[model samples]
Target: MATTGVITVSAVVLRNAAGSSVLTVRKRGTTSFMFPGGKPEPGETAAETLIRELEEELGVNLDPAALRPLGVFRAAAANETGFEVEATVFEHPTVPIGGPAAEIDEVRWLDLGLEIIPDDIAPLTALMLPALRADPRER
Candidate 1:
């Protein structure tokens, strides 16, 4: 199905020291696992939105200057059905320090080659598998 519309935002690919795994989080009352991010506030840039969201949802502080552009990614919106999520993804190449802040209910580290992604995954994450599998950092 064609996307009804797009919800623009930013996201972080929080990787471990070896970059072999990526982190995913589940929001309160939500079954799907997705990257930590949210819709941008009016006039807010994508990076800024991601920065705020990471702190709000994960209790982790990200150095704004450290956010690396990972290009724009697109997938069906997990929460808003019939729509697409337009994500300006960033890379935070670090092992997150804290966990379960704000609306976050659970956290999981997805091993690119080993773990079978659950059906209850957000769209962007569903679209990310091939890249994660081919990523040199995951090798």
Candidate 2:
């Protein structure tokens, strides 16, 4: 049976220099691509969780200071049916290059310039696309 309830996680957006695209990842057994992040350990702050998750999933160690608040968002869980995701999202000041690690199966750059987001993205990724496009840094 599918698990139900809200999953609280810390996610990050790592954009290319042009900010036209962001990095996304797919877990080992999942189809949808979402921001690279995971659930926090007990008592971990949002930033702490993101920093640890980024390094674990992508092998990119991030400074806590480099994470910019990107606002909290909620969406349907991509891999877990009957559950929703509440993500405390952050944006890394600079894009980091890394490969799949831990439970990650693949990594890809998601183009923010597309008029339509691909169906394979998680709901949180879809929700953030418009905002990312309008960001001044993309200019």
Candidate 3:
């Protein structure tokens, strides 16, 4: 049997302000902006993977107290990588620390209603945007 493992985990982080959402542009070789996260290491839980990824990718340490589970979504990897991904999404209140890491070329807060998020990430965005826009306080 061909096996498909969930290849990545991600988080939809909202700023303290209600109207914005975080998006990170991939470094030159990749396509589309995405939430801050990556593949999990051995034995790590989804939440643990999320926290570590956020720190490595964005340079911010997420307060466990502020981590809110959003939902999980599956999508084709944007890069045409054969592995499909199941992203466990979370919402968090964050402060920017050091600049975005090298893998991230740019970072911006997008208007949930206005940006053209890539198709691969669209499903996760679709699931979370409405609530983020309606109530920043919700996960």
Candidate 4:
């Protein structure tokens, strides 16, 4: 019998500061700028995963009460690894703390009008970019 695999659950945090958007750059081996998030551990909910990953990657703790679930999206693998992912996107008010954790190479606040976001991000995310640019809090 063939074994069925589980989908990886991740979150992409959308944080806006002073009318600018926040993004993180992974190491050279990874794809372009991405929101802070990662896979969910066993028995953990998506929201829990978002909170934990954000804190781990960005060094800022998000108030559980402040997380607003934007929506869920799925896309083909962005990296060479062929595993598909189901990403739960969220909009949150965040503040930068200390330096980013080891997983993150650099972090910056980008102009909402940035013209060169990577093409590997999900199509659904790209579709929402226009609206997000207009209102970062829009889910």
Candidate 5:
């Protein structure tokens, strides 16, 4: 059956060393940046989807056991008009290895403190900012 309306994605909110910034990526032709992840394959859990996507886009390998649940986030899809993304978010500590591969066009470590309204951004990213910046370690 074809899915409709909101698209669900699983994403990781990884922080760079010292936890000063969070990682975001712009896909192949998109300028807006968001957490790294994608839609799940049939029968796959959100964490499994994130593990697969991270490897494809960032050359990062992960043990599904390592991911910690953050929460579910929702906002308008960045590039897909008229749709929203319902993201199941996770947090992992390790920074990625080689990146900007596959559908990824750019890799950026944006400070959690940066204004949520950047020139170009995924709505999901904007929605997560306040919580990220509010984390005791981020302050």
Candidate 6:
């Protein structure tokens, strides 16, 4: 397949209290579960994008100060064919309690403790799962 242009986005890893699990979401028509976030709007910073996305998708308002940079990653786009995703990932200081909203169809708590992640996950989630599982911690 021919490569499409990259999609820039921001995402967060919201771990459960035990850090055994992290939050993931599936958009309305998407099969692959991914971190709860979306692409940035015009002129939005990464943290701003995350805060807006969280509020829109999960009805949770996040403080920019509470987001810790996890690193940037690039992977095959989960739902968009022939495109790559460039994600600025963050680790949330605490899990925000919320349900699926907006374009989100389902909210799932993915068990990081599992030896193998399920096949129905976005490439970016799969890429980071190992590191998260190896270093589970409580906030």
TM-score of each: 0.89, 0.93, 0.74, 0.75, 0.90, 0.96
Q: Which candidate gets the maximum lDDT versus the true structure?
A: 6
- What local lDDT score does residue 83 receive in model 1, on the 0 to 100 scale? 93
Report lDDT per candidate.
Answer: 0.81, 0.87, 0.63, 0.63, 0.84, 0.90
lDDT of 1 by residue, 53-86 (tens): 8888888888888888879988888888789889
Pairing residues by index, what is the TM-score of model 1?
0.89
Query: Residue 7 error for model 4, in Å?
Result: 4.5
Q: Where does candidate 6 clash, by residue pair?
A: none
Question: What tens digits encode model 5's per-residue C-alpha lDDT throughout 1-139?
Answer: 3324798899998887777788889999888999889999999999999999999899998778778898998888888887888999998876546768999999988877665468776889888888878882621
Give the best candidate by TM-score: 6
Global local distance difference test of model 1? 0.81
lDDT tens digits, residue span 1-139, model 4:
2223335666655555554665544533665455667778899888899778777877778777888888887654444345555688777765655566757776655456778755555443455567678774432
Candidate 5 scores a C-alpha RMSD against the true structure in Å of 3.4
Each prediction's RMSD over C-alphas, in Å, is 2.0, 2.2, 3.7, 4.2, 3.4, 1.0
Clash count (model 2, backbone only):
0
Report residue 114 deviation for candidate 3 (angstroms).
1.1
Candidate 6 on 1-139: residue-level lDDT in tens? 8777899999999988888899999999889999988899999999999999999889888878889999999999999999999999998867566888899999999998788779998999999998887888875
Writing each residue's lDDT as its tens digit, candidate 2 over 60-114 gives 9888877889899998889888999999999887655789999999999988878
Candidate 3, 34-68: lDDT as tens digits? 66777779998888887787777667787777778
Error of 6 at 78 (Å): 0.6
lDDT of 1 at 105: 93
What is model 1's C-alpha RMSD? 2.0
